[model samples]
Target: MSIMRRFSFNHATAKFWDQREAVEACARTGSGIGLWREPVQEMGLEASAKLVKDAGVQVTSLCRAGFFTDPTQAAIDDNRKAIDEAAELGAPTLVLVSGGIPEGGTIDSAREGVKEALSVLAPYAGERGVTLSIEPLHPMFASDRCVVTTINEALDLAAPFPAGQVGVVVDTYHIWWDPQVWQGIARAGREGRIASFQFADWVTPLPAGVLTGRGQLGDGCVDFKRYLAEVDATGFTGPIEVELFNDALWARPGAEVFEETRAAFARVLE
Candidate 1:
């Protein structure tokens, strides 16, 4: 028998392509997809949802939620809307990139804000049958993108929630360099917290904004087969998503990018 697995292409990987076309391509390739919020909103959530559904494409996750570092009511409200959006689209996971340091405070305070925000949002996500996947961005993004910068940190933050309610996203680009990555993966599996598993190889001399330097699947140093094995050992059977943020990819036609990414992802897995 074959080692059955599912692959998902995140919308960010198709930033160069039109959103609908991206989803269509993933569907045609018999893979799943992860949606981004802005494009979904711009295309109209209901319409986008219908498009994916009609294409017979599974939505592994919705790109984001939980930027509530300030822990303000507005932040909470926005997250709630995000949860609703995820639920509306039948996405099982809502990837959360915890907001960075606030203007007036320190990283510790921002973390505390994350705790408060999650405390408020977790129950709602749980009730709606959506998993909130807390993503630990790379340390390079520590100050502005996400304060949660390691799998361990993400797991610690998720420790308080129910297993199926809140979880951590394991994105190779962000956590690959960590010394305790294996331990973190083990812990997350033991706790049933690996909600989304994403791939984006690393590239040195990271770009200025540090957002567009993602390497293609097999072109970078990531040992994808090993990563997949670790995830498999955890008994987490969710789709493995490719989420590259490279500018070159965005300059190509969505179909070409999607095909190339899918091929690379499959090649590395083999």
Candidate 2:
């Protein structure tokens, strides 16, 4: 198959896009899609599942379900729900943004909480045929958005679980700056723990919050060709999901953004 055929558009890349429209675009293009929780809930899980099933679009992964920094029973319950949703949608992976340090808690404590959380959720996810993909966000977001800040860290956190139950997400935007990224990817692949592979470029002059500043593919300095080569060397032939959280992109229409992003993905890979 062509490289473009491996493209999967992540819904959060176009944050406000209607869920049905995003799935339809994937269907029409014979691409895969990654969905988020809010929109799935809004559309109703069964209806959303049926929609994708009828359209013949692959649900690559589900957006998120792992803010267990505080490690409450409620948090574990929610993660179980997320696993169920992924199974219903035919998504093999559920991307997890393990939340940052809780108020009054140290970062060390937060990391432990993630471990505890994973221990609780991994078995449930395995039973549902879903892999909980631990996403290590950029170090800049370590204090608030996500404490897991490197592919290595994510892999370590996933170590105690079966690869089929827990794995790591290799998002370029998050790990491109890591000097040992290639090593991390190889390790993840060697251990059979690569669950999701996402793309987004790194741009400077980050926004005030730094959350919506992800650069479009090829618009920034990420060496995607090198990334692809390294990842492909590891035998990962799955969907390469493009996920850009750019304020400028979100301001435009979803259809336009989808086309532009898809074109960008093709250009970068080519």
Candidate 3:
């Protein structure tokens, strides 16, 4: 198969794109797609599932299902629902962005909360044949977006559970700045915890919130070839999802963005 066969387009790259059009684009290109819960729900779960299934497209992963830094019952219930949705959509992994510190809580406390929440949800996800993928966002967002800021930390949180039930996401955008990234990737591979592999270049001059500033492949400082080599050395031959959150890309037509992003992926990998 061609290397492009392993490319999966993440819907958030074009935040404003219509769900059906995204799926159709993926279908046309014979690529997989990573979906978000909100759009999936808005388009109706069963309908969304049918759309992909009929189009012969794969659901690389479900965007996210974790935010239980506080570990409340409601949070647990919601994650269970997310797992159910992943199963319905034939997504093997459900990404988890462990929420940041809650009010009156320290980062340490939030970390503990994530551990407790996973203890409750891991078994449920396992039963449904879905892997809970912990995604470590950039450290800049550690205070408000995601407390999990390193692959090692995510691996540590996942260590307590079975590799099949709990795993880590290796997104270059979030980890390229880490000095020990290569070591972390090897360790994750050794532990059999690499559930998802995503790509998003890191650009400077981050925006105010720093949420929608993800750079396109080859436009930023990320060394895609190096990342690919390291990940391949780990024996990880899974789909590589390109998940950019760029404001400029969002403003353009979805089809145009998709084609450009796809070409960029190929160029960088080449």
lDDT of each: 0.89, 0.93, 0.94
Report the lDDT tens digits of candidate 2 across residue range 167-210: 99999999999999999999999999989999999877776747
Give the 10-residue window scoring lowest on summed lDDT in candidate 3: 202-211
Model 1, residue 11: what's the lDDT? 90
Task: Give each model a TM-score.
Answer: 0.97, 0.98, 0.98
lDDT value, candidate 1, whole model: 0.89
Q: Which ten residues in a row have the lowest lDDT in candidate 2?
A: 202-211
Give the winner by lDDT.
3
User: Alpha carbon lDDT of residue 139, candidate 3?
Assistant: 95
Clash number for candidate 1: 0
TM-score between model 1 and native: 0.97
Off by over 4 Å in 3: none
- Residue 247's C-alpha lDDT in candidate 2? 88
RMSD of 1: 1.3
Global local distance difference test of model 2: 0.93
